[model samples]
Target: MDWQQILTNVAGEIIAPTTAAYALAAIGLNVHFGMTGLLNFGQAGFMLLGAYGYAIASIAGWPVWAAVLVALACAVVFALILGIPTLKLRGDYLAIVTIAAAEIIRMIGRSTSMTEVTGGNAGLAGDGFKGSFQELSPLPDGNFAIGPWSYSMNLSNSWWVRIVGWALVALACFLVWRWMNSPWGRVLKGIREDEDAVRSLGKNVYAYKMQALVLGGAIGAIAGIVYALPRAVQPDSMGRPMTFYVWTILLLGGAATVFGPVLGSILLWTTLMLVKTVLRDVIPATVLRSEQIEMLGWVLVGVTLMLLVIFRPQGILGDRKELAIDVR
Candidate 1:
């Protein structure tokens, strides 16, 4: 109800570490779906593996570097396993396989038998894992303000995550932009437009597909590690909805553009938070329950998405040429 509080929420959403995490995931999605023309509907699976791998390694007393290595390794392995069998399949088969694979990973995390390792449905606590990372905070414990924005190291205490997360996002975006400008990146675009033409030109289409899958999955895994660093690694957090949200961010910004994911994430989260804030303030509690107000916020988001697609299918930053995909 407070206008100042609502404005803060809207502004903070774009700068939040969570937004950076989603931006990283969307960047990975851009590599697969945007540049490579690969339909990866199970990005959440990549995140799940990365998060759990890091958490498990930490619980096993692994150092931060080793735990990160294990997470990236798990993501690559998962991509290979998933891509080798289904990358060659045509017509939404990859999408189906990826979605199923994501669900399978989630189920594995939630399985009763893996409780000791995965923490079952309750998920793994970071108390045993976050020490090494938290110890590396550069900012001294105190309150600090940067112009209009205020931060407290001891209060909400997410300044460290924000610093690391935004740095990684910037680095990831730079790397993606560099890769997509190379010759190898051209083949990815070719495969997306017309795989048959690319294959006829003697290019290894399958190999390229596999490579894209691996790279994107690996990035997704890194995003997962970033995501989990600020919170507990929960299996449910890496579900289908998460993948959809990543897709939304990618599509909203302009899928094939180098900075689209970053822009899209900022816009999408800002709008979502803005809507939630307005709805919670404007809507009377007597008319709608708290949960219903939340649902209405999402509904408004869906309506906005529909309007965007109808008016500009290429997205806010996407060129029509970049969206010329051959579905066959």
Candidate 2:
């Protein structure tokens, strides 16, 4: 294997639109858990609904804007569905219900009965769905090179996706930062610290929680849109592992910080890519199979999470004060 080629491929993924997509989703999670103290483990469900909502609307000949609106609407509905019964409950219950609900959504999408609509296990195509977005590409149709890394302007279909994806990520980050610094954001922080106290202070704790869920879920929906833009939409793409990955990004970046999610995503993905590339190069091919290397990467992530929890639970940019929640 060409070691140089491996490094290049790894680097590409590190900065790819997908990384930004995850960052956006993790920022949403930061709002839910880091700020509001909501234990939402079903972020994948919101993402799935967003992806499917847009794809299905496009398939039905709706305008791009309408499709996006439908996706956002779906996210709101999902939030209401999950938040109505459990938002009043304690932390662990909310986590359990949300996680289970997310899995149920994924499994239902993969079911054969819904194959006609969801494409079932085969996934759905985005042929016309992405056309409108792609048409807005500002770059000329050709190749562009920078240093040892070069990318096709029009060849891989990633140009349009990257443009829109990065744009949305920037928008989400800006909105999150602004919101987190507002009076509403302060209430969220107060709720995270002591919901009962906020309620005693004449604040509507339940309403605040619901609003946080809706806003965070909406952000997750946008992440789903960006994530599915570059490729086909598959149910498996929004699996439990995806939520775990988002959580990892949130924690890695310092959950309550404005820019933590973005930085954490870039750092985590880059480190993962670099490790895979280096291991692929130095590890004796004769000793370890390709599949083994893949497993080894996951093992490393698990060990890293363990270490983080034990040592620096506040994450890279997180403050110990921000993480002081009364989950009990």
Best by lDDT: 1
For 1-328, candidate 2 gives per-residue lDDT tens digits of 6868877776777668789789889988988998899999999998998999998888888888898999999999989988988899878988999999999989999999999999999878867477665655787877777666676664334655666777787888888888889999999999998899999999999999999999999999989888888777899989999999999888888888888898888877877777777777779889888788777877787788778766887788888877772323
Tens-place lDDT digits, model 1, residues 70-100: 9999999999899988998865987898999
The lDDT of each candidate is 0.88, 0.84
What residue runs in model 2 are displaced by over 4 Å at the alpha carbon? Answer: 1-7, 154-157, 325-328
Cand. 1 Cα-lDDT: 0.88
Model 2 is weakest, by summed lDDT over 10 consecutive residues, at 152-161
Cα deviation at 120, candidate 2, in Å, is 0.6
Task: Report the CA-based lDDT of candidate 2 relative to the real structure.
Answer: 0.84
